[model samples]
Each structure stands twice: as structure tokens, then as C-alpha cells.
Target: MRKTVSLFAMLTALLVLLAACGGNQTGGSAGSSGAAGGGEKKTIKFGATAGPYSDMVTKAIKPLLEKKGYKVELVEFNDYVQPNKALANGSIDANLFQHILYLKQFATDNKLDIQEVISVPTAPMGLYSNKFKTLDSIENGSLLTIANDPSNLARSLLMLQSMGLITVKKDVNAATLSEKDIVDNPKSLQFKPVEAASLPRTLDSTALAVVPGNFALAAGMDLTKALKLEEMAENYRNVIAIKTADKDSQFAKDLKEAVQSDEFEKTIDEQFKGFSKPQWMTGK
Candidate 1:
């Protein structure tokens, strides 16, 4: 009878021990707890295009995050679409490749629940030419390659207008401006819209190409070789994007703090020399 009682006691203790072990396992999941608790996540996956944007995260942001007890993993993407998709699907914790305008438009269009954590320094879009040395040398009906994406298309078109190559309608909303908005093209320039990633390659085929800073740098083109560099607006600067639900979480705050740190600015100054500073960084 005593042996039977001992066996029962042992079985009860084993069940309790198993339950305790299961509880510990649940608590050890850093992703769920850190996000919910608004503290440091043990591992953070950052998505970015395979270029300067990714380098910014690697050279500047990752070390800072590691110091804060977070493991930083960078996922390099070849195109603009995937980084945000990864973030939306919870494949990555955040991304640093797109500007606020692009982020807003993409999120609205795709029904993705993502928001900007903070803006970072961005390289300006510029007109590069293998055929012409200057705008003065630009010929009538010269084929010009531009970004097909609506946001970047408008931005490139606006820069062209600023340079007197074209003019958008005075009454059209700038945010949603399209090729149809152009009222005059004094140069009679022909426009060919392609993917932003493909703009760098257009330089070889077209008279001129409007290359965004990130893609241009990624392609190893010298920013100084461009015929003209657009004056970047604050909203046009690239930003770190996180899931909107995580916006108020602790990881979001930490990510913001890292970007705004003086060390981040110093790193930008040293490595990303030609990149334009955002208003927050410039104190403007």
C-alpha cells in the first residue's frame, strides 16, 4: 500500500514539473514578450534594399542595437516591394529603405498596417547621363528614363519641372501627380517609366536617367557625376518603418532613439558623405 502511495506521489510531482517547464518555455519567447512589454527584443530582423540603405543599417544601426541587448539581423532585398511586404507579414521587425511618402502611399494602397518609426538621411535623386555632359547638351525628344512607381515618378517629374525640363499643372495635387499632370515639355522629352531598381541600367540605354540616391549608389555610380541633384524635401527622406501596432511598443522607441543618436549622425557624416540630412537631423 505504501509503495502504491509513493508511485502516485511521484506521478503528481512529474506532472507539476512538466507544467513548470512549459511555462518557462513560454516566457522565454523574446519576440512576443519584448514586443508586448515594450522592451528590448532579443532578436530583431531589419529588412532593406541591397545597397546604401542596407549599409546604413549595418554600419550605423546594428552596433547600437547590439549594445542595447538586441540581436540585429539584416535581410537584404533587391527591390522596394519586398522589404515592406516582409515587414507586413512579420518576416522582419522593421525596414529602412523607403521615405515617408512612399511608406504612406504603399501602406494605403496595399492595406498594410505599417508606420514610420523615424526618418533618416537620404541620397537625393539626380539626373545622370552617359550621352550628354550637361542639361545644355540635352537634345529635343531625348529619351529619359524615370521611376515607374507613382511616388518616385512624381518626385522625379517635380525635379525635372524645377529644372525647366517640364512643368506639372498648377492646379494638380503634388502628392498624386502623374504623367498626365504635365502641361508643357519644352524639351519635348520622351518619358520611359521603369522600375526604380532598373533606373541605373537605363543610363546605358537612354540619353538621361533620373536615378534615386539609393539605387544609384547601389549601382556604384558616383553621385557627383550626375548632371543635377534634386533638393530633397524632409518628407522625401527615407525612414525606418515598423508595424503600426508596434508603434507604441518599447522596441519602436528604442529604434527611434538609436537613429536620433549623435553617433548615428556621425556615422552618416563619415560614410554617407553625399546624403542629405533630414529636418530632424539638421534641427530645421
Candidate 2:
């Protein structure tokens, strides 16, 4: 009778232990899902190109969001194309890289419903030359390179026009202008359209190359040495973007607020080192 009782006790203990283990697992999972202080935290997956955009997010925005019990996952892309693709497919929650103009053009052309949340800063486009010391030194028929992408190509052309190197057709929209829009090329400057990312690489071969600020920074080109730099304009300021459906979402609001925060502005000043001018300062 005692042996049978002992066996029964052993079975009871085993059952109790199993129940305790199961209970612990359930609690663990619940705790895991909750933040340290016991509330659910939302994770925002933000996409950006791999340079200043990612740097700013890492240095500023990520910490700001995390302090508010949010998790920020930064997805870095090498090219301008994939960040929007990721956002549209729901692979990411938002993106911060392109300007209002680029974002609008990309969304319209790709039939994506992405929209801007807030403007960040302007990385002004610059014209740089390794061969020529001054614009006057550039001879007629000399080869010049510019970004082939629609928005940047137009920006590059406008920069050239501003320098009196070329004249674009009157009433032609600066955002969509092309080589064909050039009504007069006083220098007879031959234009070579290359990938925006490749314009820096072409500096050695081309007489002059107009490079976006981000690309110029990446190539270690001194902005002070640029023959000409495009002035920061409202349309050219980079912005955070999200799906149109998420325009009013809490995540979107949090992101916009975080970037617009004073802390983020300080970070931008520190990280970009005045290379990119904050749009807020310009009131744009």
C-alpha cells in the first residue's frame, strides 16, 4: 500500500512540475511580447539609402523612438529604387531618402501610393571638375556628365542653367527638364548622361560632372572646391515618406515627430556637419 502511495505521489509531483513549466513558458512569452515596464511596444521598420540618411537615423531617430518604448528597425538600401519598393510592398513601414520631387515622380511612375510625411534637410547638388579649375576653363565641345535619373537630371540641368552654361526653354518645368529642353548651349558643352551614383566616378574622365550632395560626400569631394552648388530649394529637401494609407497612423506620426525634434536637429548638425542644410532653418 505504501509503495502504491509512493508511486501515486511521484505521478502527482510530475504532473505539478509539468504544469508549472507550462505556466512559466506562457508567462515568458507574454513578457517577451510586452516592453520592460509591461506595455506592448510597436516596431517601426524604416528604410533609407546607405549614407547620410542611415547615419542620421542611427545617430538620432533610433534612440528617440526607443526611449518612447518603440523599436526601430532601419533597413538600408544601396540604390534609390529599392527603398520605395520595400515600403510599397509592406516590407518596411517608412522611408527617408528622396526629396519631395523624387518621391512624387517615383510614386507616379511606379503607381505606388507613397507620400511624404515631413521634409528633413537639403543636400544641395554640386558641379565638380577634376580637369578644369574654373567654369571659364571649360572649352566648347568639352564633355560634361550629369545624372540620368529624371529628377536629378533636371536638377543638374537647372544648375547648369543657373551658372549661365546653358539656357533651358522658357516655361519648361525645371523638375522635368532634359537635354532636349536646352535651347542654347553657349559652350556647345557635350552632355553625357550617367547613373547618378556613377557621376562621381566620371570626374576623372569628364570635363565637369554635376553630383548630388550625398553622392559628392560619399566620394569625399570637397564642397568648397565645387565649381558651383545648387541652392537649397523647398522641392529639393529630402523627406520622410510612408504609404498614403498610413498618413494618419501613430507610427507615422511618431516618426515625423522624432525627426522634427530638437534632438534630431542637433544630431543632423553634428552628423552632417553643415554639409546638408536643415530645411527648418530655411523655413522650407
Candidate 3:
């Protein structure tokens, strides 16, 4: 009789131990507690460039990520260089500030530990001018100002090449182009590689100015005002990038899902109507 009573007590203690272990592992016990229900959850760190892009991450993406069981902490940077550097140094898990071209150049030029993981949105820069009402109005010998920065220079010149203003050598690298790179210039248009921000200010000084869509929007010029543009839809494969080592992980999956959420895509459509679209919000 005494032996039976001791066995009953032992069994009850074992059952209690099993229940406690389950609670610790599952974080979903009867009363609710663990790493989830009313318990501490994991976190994800991300960085964004200053401007509307940062706002999108905070207001749209962050909340969606939180819903999927991640505490998203986003850091904002005013300059372009820091985000990639930050990612390289392990300061950030991912960055959403650059397109594939920008990422490629940044990774190559700095030899940073990064890669172009995926494209988020494409910003088709345009040739904006307040002086000349139309492209045809600009004289052939007229001078045009493009961005001097290597990254913007390539994009600006590419737009010009597409519009038949000039032609870059087929063999030349797109990111490190210069005046000598112009293989064909039948129009006799002078090319000036001025600072990107100065391009708009030089509208009167130069016959034409190649301005990025972001700066154009900041300058209050509509897409209709541009003399020429890339056929790429606004939100074409820009990119959301992660470190080279993190390409294969569940964290990458969460980041992808949060950025490509239907809710986030709607914000892209409404907020960046001409500046971006959601057709490129895809990938595994």
C-alpha cells in the first residue's frame, strides 16, 4: 500500500516536469509563456536611406515584419555610402537603399562583403530642363550637364544614349564612363559631368540637365516634364540587399516576405505613383 502511494507521487512529479519542459520549448503553455505568447521574441535589424524610402520601411514593412514574429529595428542613414559599409561591418542585417547597379558598384569599388540579392524598385532618371521647353528646341551645339559621380554619370549618360543624344563605347564599362567614352556624338552636344544635385541648378546654364527621379520629385518636376526616360516601369527590379554570407537563411525569407507583402506593395503604388510601382516586388 505504501509502495503504491509513492509510485503515484512519483508519476505526478514526472508529469509536472514534462509540462514545464514543454512550456519552455514551445512558449505556448496553458497560461501562455515562452519565446512567443507573452514571451520574448526575436528581432531583425535593417537600414534605410533618408527620404521616402525610409518612411516606407518604418510605416509599412516594419509592422508587417512584427506581425510575423520579428521585432524589426530600422536604422536610418542620410548618405548612401554608410548603409553598404554598415552592412559589410555586420552593423545591419539588410539594407534597402540601392538598385542593382548601385549595389554592384558599391560592392566592387569598396570591396565590401555584399551582393545584389534582389531588386525592389527602379527609378528611371530623366532629362529635366526649365529653359528649353522641348528636346527639339535645344540647339545641337548646346551643352548638357550630367552627374559627375561615377554612379549617376553612367545612369545619366545611358538615358542620353537611349535618347540618341550620344553613344557610349560598346566595350566601356557603364559605371566608370567619361567624355572619352562617348563614341558617337553627331549632335555636337557638349557633355558636362557636374555633381548630381548641381545638375538641376544648372538647368539655365546648360541646355539640358539629366536628373534622377528622386531629385526631380524633390525639385517639384513631374515625369511629364522630362524630355526622355527609361522604358522600365517605375518600380522595376531596384533591390533589397543582404550580406553575401546571409543569402541562405530563414531571416532572408522573412525580409523578403515583409518587403513584398501585398500591403507594402499598395503603399508603393499609392505613394510612388510615377516614381515607383509594385510589378518588381517578387523573388523567393
Candidate 4:
């Protein structure tokens, strides 16, 4: 009888301990959220989509920020939306993956006060296809897939217009092209807007597809002779973006310097040979 009673008491104690631990965890999370806005720490957080460029910022820029007596934290964002939203909401200090035009679109769309601080590097988008060797060989009504995201969709459409597949309004900027902007549609190509990374796999399925340079590299698509590439010089340069309030902040300058540095660009050149090829595309 005493043995049985001891076991029951031990079980009761274990249950109580578990409940207390759970409560502590919940309280910890709540405490952090409450204190987030009141912290006096000398640190800045940067958000970037998980990719090579973002890794570059973490590897190169984070150190620079720290050397200047600022604690730096790097946050990775998976989707197109939340990173900028976090920046606007004070969740992160800045973001680096976006281009100038797209940053403007992000600002306008979300009604945020972020602005482009530095043009980092152009990813140089392209039309890659196993079905059609060249644009002229592409059939009328060739099913073309593009990125479905608002920013990338516009980029793809601008490339299509640049290739003469369609015509857009004279006043429409490449950053803001929409399906409605297709002023001329001669070939009547069937447009399929898909996720950016998924387009390379569908290359065999679609007659033609617009792909960003980084994803093309990820998919092992050869651009040496297999595809036509967009020029980075005159347009389509990517940049480091930040909240307008933090535009001139110390961390922003460190990020811009780190990305634009010769050492970092060398890494980009070596890792991504073709699209990151054009030197003029970099902010340096």
C-alpha cells in the first residue's frame, strides 16, 4: 500500500512540474513580445530571402556591422511578402533581396515607408527553353510560364515586351507592368504565371519561360548558348532596401559597403558565373 501511494505522489509531482514548465515557456514568449518595442540594445536586424545573395550579406555584411560596435542579426524570410512587412512593422531593420522598382512597388502596395538605399546587383532575368532554341522559332500561342508573384510577374512581362512578344504602354515602367499593359499582342502567346523556382522544371513542358538568373543557376540551366539573357546595365538593377526612417542608419551603410565590396562581388562572380557576369550591374 505504501509503495503504491509513493508512485502516485511522484506522478502528481511530475505532472505539476510539466505544467509549470509549459507556463514558463508561454510566459517567456509573451515577455519577449512585450519587451521587443522597448529594448535599448544597440543592434539592427536584417531580413533576406534564403538564397546566395542573402548568405553573402550575412557572411560579409554582418561582420562589418559588428566591427563598428553594432550587434547584427540576420533573419531569413521564405516568401515575398513578410520580409518587407517586417521591415515596415519594425520587426527587422532592413531587407536586401529586392530591386529598386520592386522596392517601390512594395512600398506603394503595402503603404509602407521603405525606400531603396543602394542598388546591389542585377540578377539579369532570361528566357530559357528546351522547346524553342530561339524566340523566332517560338510558335504563336506558345505556352509561356512566368513568376506569379507581383514583382516577378512584372519583371517577366517587361522581358516579354523587350523581346517583342508583346507591346506595353509607353508610360508604363518596367517595374509596374501588368497584363493590362500588353498594348500589342501579336503572337498571342498563352501566358502561364507560376512560382519562379518551379518554372525551370517546367521548361520541358512550356514552349518558353521567363526565369530569374539565380533560380536558373539553381536548376543547372546553361545560358552560354541555351538561352537569351536580359542586360543588367540600362535597367533591372537590384538593391538594398530599408525603412525610410532607417535610410541613413549605420547598419544600412555597412550592408551596402559589404555587398558592393570587391571581395563579395568576387564570390558572386565565381559562384554565379553567367548572370552575375556583367560587372556594371553591381553597385560598385
**TM-scores of all models?**
0.79, 0.76, 0.75, 0.66
TM-score of 2: 0.76
lDDT for predicted candidate 1 compared with the true structure: 0.87
> In model 4, where is the ten-residue run with the lowest total lDDT?
27-36
lDDT by residue for model 1 (126-170), tens: 999999998989999999999988778988999999888999998
The clash numbers for all candidates, in the given order, read 1, 0, 5, 0
RMSD of each: 4.4, 5.8, 5.3, 11.8
Best by lDDT: 1
What's model 2's overall lDDT?
Answer: 0.80
Q: Whole-model Cα lDDT per candidate?
A: 0.87, 0.80, 0.71, 0.70
Q: How displaced is residue 132 in candidate 3, in Å?
A: 2.8
TM-score of 3: 0.75
A best-first ranking of the candidates according to their TM-score comes to 1, 2, 3, 4
The runs of at least 3 residues in candidate 2 whose Cα sits more than 4 Å from the true structure, single-residue gaps closed, are 1-41, 109-111, 133-142, 173-176
State the TM-score for model 1. 0.79
| Residue 58 in model 1: lDDT | 97
Kindly list the per-residue Cα lDDT of model 3 for residues 1-284, writing each as its tens digit: 99999999999999999999977774332222111344422565678876656766787678887787766778889888999999888777778877776688779999997875555654568887766777677777888888888777876777778878788889788657777788888879887777776666788677788887666666666766687766563323467787887776556666676666788777767666565443555432
